[model samples]
Target: MDDDLHPDGAQDGREPRSGGANLLVFLALLPLDALVGGHAWLVVGMNGWAAAHNGEEATVPVTELVVSGGVPAAAGLALCWGRYWGAAVAQFALTAVLMAWLLSFQG
Candidate 1:
């Protein structure tokens, strides 16, 4: 009996260079993470300012930026490391949402 799929066998007896592959993905997304981290810092500063001045603390991007940026970063890394072809698609889609949300903050 020939089995088409085996649980313990590598396809070519060679594991994918996941370290290198994941490094590329991380490098590619580093800029976005930097931006997200910067914005998070800004949000923290603004909230601190608001508290100091007794300004309205409502409607701030308390977790919007976190969710928009963090989810994509983590998910993209996992998906890329796992060799998922949809990694790019999901990453960019989340990027779009982030960008749009950022723009919303601008207004």
Candidate 2:
């Protein structure tokens, strides 16, 4: 089965590449960060637009959203080239931080 999958028997007698693992971690984390970051930006934009149209102050500050969302998204992208174990650890830490920050807004 392994041979059928590898085709050239390239899976034998070699350690897994850290770059491949890091790339996988990067790919997996990036979309999630993007999605949450995009939603945060959208919400902030809509609120700003509505506030401007109605002559009221925006409820959510743009800086807050950028810091909360942008940092993690950028970190995820940076992980694509980072050391394997380091990237994995940072991925978990960043994920936790992002989740906690998101949950803080819940009533």
Candidate 3:
């Protein structure tokens, strides 16, 4: 006669999980992150294109995009299987960072 709404805590039961759920969450986010990361990485490609086309260096924006996109995603992947709160916070921060990066690209 269990009464807990989840029976497994809020998400990861606040204890050691079997890693499946975290893996699933990671898989779910992988595509989205890859899409965004790929777009961000394209800044490098754009730099090459622009450099070849206009003979100018575009260093700062490319580096900024790579750092902003890659680091948080790597952090998110690293923390996805830690704890419930860890996962939640990582996901939230990841989303926020992604959104902020996306917004930054808007003209």
Candidate 4:
């Protein structure tokens, strides 16, 4: 056993390196963060379009923004952290909010 690599006397077969773990965590979060950030931008763009079309009024994109941004963001975060349950919950909440928005808008 490499004593230098196992300064803390960890019994694992492979020794741990702080740098390697940090790199792995960063790589894992990279994809998730990108996806969520991209979706956030999309939500913003869509809101802009809707607002512009609605005679420049300060319309809140509660539905579009929340569902589109929140679902993907939550899912991405959950995936990065290996939390399937959180992802599922986020999906359900987003769906419900979207449905409510749709029904309310159907006036």
All candidates' lDDT scores?
Answer: 0.59, 0.62, 0.59, 0.52
lDDT of 3: 0.59
Tell me model 2's lDDT, rounded to 2 decimals.
Answer: 0.62
Q: Show model 1 residue runs off by greater than 4 Å.
A: 1-17, 55-62, 65-107
Give the candidate number with the greatest lDDT. 2
How many steric clashes does model 2 contain? 0
Write the residue-wise lDDT of candidate 1 on 13-95 in tens digits. 33444555645765676677667756765775576577658865434564666575665667666765567435455575666
- Across residues 1-107, which tens digit of lDDT does each residue of candidate 3 receive? 34443765554345644457666665676676667667665765576678768876544364556565665566575665465344545565766776565545433
User: Mind giving the per-residue lDDT tens digits that candidate 2 earns over 13-101?
Assistant: 44334766766776777777767666775676687788889997656654666566656656655654354555655665766675556
The TM-score obtained by model 4 is: 0.40
Q: Report residue 85 deviation for candidate 2 (angstroms).
A: 3.5
How many Å off is the CA of 29 in candidate 1?
A: 0.6
Question: Model 4 off-target regions past 4 Å?
Answer: 1-17, 58-107
- Highest TM-score, which number? 3
Candidate 4 residue-wise lDDT, 6-82, digit = tens: 56876545433355454555465556545654665556566667877887754445665566556545554554454
Q: Which ten residues in a row have the lowest lDDT in candidate 3?
A: 9-18
In model 1, the worst 10-residue window by lDDT is 9-18
Overall local distance difference test of candidate 1: 0.59
